[model samples]
Target: MKLLRNILFTSTLLMSAFAAGTAANADPGRFMDMKKSVKAPIGHKQFCQDNGWACPRESYDPVVVQLNEELWQQLIAVNAEVNRRVKPMTDNDLFGKEEHWSYPVNGYGDCEEYVLEKQRVLMEAGWPKSALLITVAKDVQNSGHAVLTVRTDHGDMILDNQIEAVLPWYSTPYRYIKRQSASSPVAWTGIADTRVTTVSSVSR
Candidate 1:
């Protein structure tokens, strides 16, 4: 009788552990539901391969080169536009318009909106579908927001509307959670620091 009770307890614990693991790994279908919620495309496998610190590309296609150059130029233009538009607004202005910022729009957007818009424009400009990725992070103040990361042959560069210069990802202070990929749902390797939250977005 004692042996049977022990076996049953162990089996119950194991089953509970398995169920928890499955839920953790299951896809949440966020991409399918939020397809139109954001502008970028759904497929992100190639983007992950290209932007990862380790991958290498042989050479850029002529078309890719042209598109990259054009997109680079456009990113610069958009950064300038965002700075011009958002610089004057006080913190209260942003808080007051938080609802507008949350909704998707064709034109006119806040910081995150500007990033998403720029990402879409870059994709349309001919940059490799994988070259542009939308990264959502908590700002220094712990506010949730989005930014654009451009994966280049050398490394990933950040195009932030808050700053005119495009800096490398490591240079920025924002803590990374999970980046949106074209091919798969978001993944979190680890948090940058204790302040950074684990990825809260659902996988597709």
Candidate 2:
């Protein structure tokens, strides 16, 4: 009787462990990629006004403003703000799990989703589309990851959720991969290094 009871208990424990593992693997939130940017048409006058100049201005002429230095400072400040908001979620917390209720840091987001959110917030804060670049690369671990690259006059800086401090692109261990254009909404074009295979629901 003792032997039978012990066997039954061990079998139950094994089944419970297997069920838990299966549940984790079956989670639906694991596959959501990042959201793509939306584009809308703008009239010539609206475009010009949005750009803060006349429509027929010279193509390559720089905008003449008195506070160019101050504008640059403000851009830097906004970048810092974005880093502050996203770093905690990416670095300290586990992937695909919410950390806090107030901030509501998304718990189950993949790398692409994180980048999308960061780009969206920065755009809302008035950063130019040209200033932000979405870069896709393989990290040191050879796992796929996406990060935001901020192009400045100095150099390109990477705002990764994996680290708190913003570092220049060349300083990181990631290999250089193709960057998503600020002007285009396409999720991918072609990679310079490796051929990427994108899978869709229909493929299955």
Candidate 3:
């Protein structure tokens, strides 16, 4: 049901959001500390190679800030554009191999590739490289998915390929897991469940 709804609603939502032109915290503390995370997802590593990413990710420091409104709009524009342009085709469909990740050289790639392009464009847009992270999460199906998580003074904002609506980390539907450490885009970390746990407590 969720998958069906996502497929059905994504294009509609994208059009509406564009027509409207519309677009966290102690969490900031951990992001500032930026602990070492698990090894980067294997798929991400391969994607970099296949895509010819400059490798050995730069910025060993975590970029921590609540992006100003203007910057937020820029990020939103790029996220929505790439999400709109790239059509999701699995590695098997595109490359005949399972678990392969790469650039959407032809704009036909899977989730992780969507993420890499978003991050790449964001960085190219002159956004700080350290703050824009290529993150991994568990989709509704419990399969590993990739997203671009932008850190800020308030918390984290998620730029996902699955949904055109950019969501606050706490509001997103996926189960939070780990993502690239803000310090280094290459190393990932087990995202503390703190954001969701606190929000749930407050709601109740």
Candidate 4:
């Protein structure tokens, strides 16, 4: 059980680091605004077809979680634990397809899978379905990537598999693209990020 103890220690440390970065709830500018409705990602569409329960489409009022210390700690623990437990494997290698989104059944998945798992965990923990959003973005390399966006009264915080510490939407390096709408879990909305940046894909 040595490995289990080490994992617990690491999770605690992650939660502490996230709590230290806590900020008071701010104005509307801190929250990322939604634009026109957009189509859901292909992988997500197929994922919904297969796992409908995970993607709740029922209409409800948008929820912005009031970020309390307890919830903040929980988010950190969930984010870190999932990132640590799940090994990164691309869709093609794992499913023989270029793009596939599903839970990490074998403890392996790509970026979007991480997002899905985290969202699921939080929902199971009593977090609202409207608050946890599956977001798409262009990574630092300008490659397509996925991250979990958690809406809260403090702001729109991002829980990314690539990064351990939760970050505000604006603080992330990604050029915001689109995400599931807060009002409707299945509906998608565009992110009007007008920031211009130059990034080129790196060939290994």
TM-score of each prediction: 0.48, 0.45, 0.74, 0.82
Question: What ordering of candidates by TM-score runs from best to worst?
Answer: 4, 3, 1, 2
Task: Evaluate model 3: give its TM-score.
Answer: 0.74
lDDT of 4 by residue, 51-100 (tens): 99876768899988987777877988999999999999988999998888
* Residue-wise C-alpha lDDT for candidate 1, range 73-160, written one tens digit per residue: 5656766765565433322465453233221233345665566556656666666645565676666565665677676643456677
lDDT, residue 78, candidate 4: 98
Candidate 2 backbone collisions, by pair: 96-107, 96-108, 97-107, 98-107
lDDT of each: 0.47, 0.44, 0.65, 0.79
RMSD per model, one decimal: 17.8, 18.8, 9.7, 7.9
Error in Å for residue 147 of model 3: 0.6
Residue-pair clashes per prediction, in order, are 6, 4, 7, 0
lDDT of 3 by residue, 1-204 (tens): 443344236534543443322112232232323334567677767766765554566667667665566776676788899988999898898989888767685879998789888888988877777778777666555567788888776457678988777655644555556677666656677665543222221000
Per-residue error for 204 in candidate 4, Å, reads 22
Deviation (Å) of 32 in candidate 4: 1.2
Candidate order by lDDT, decreasing, is: 4, 3, 1, 2
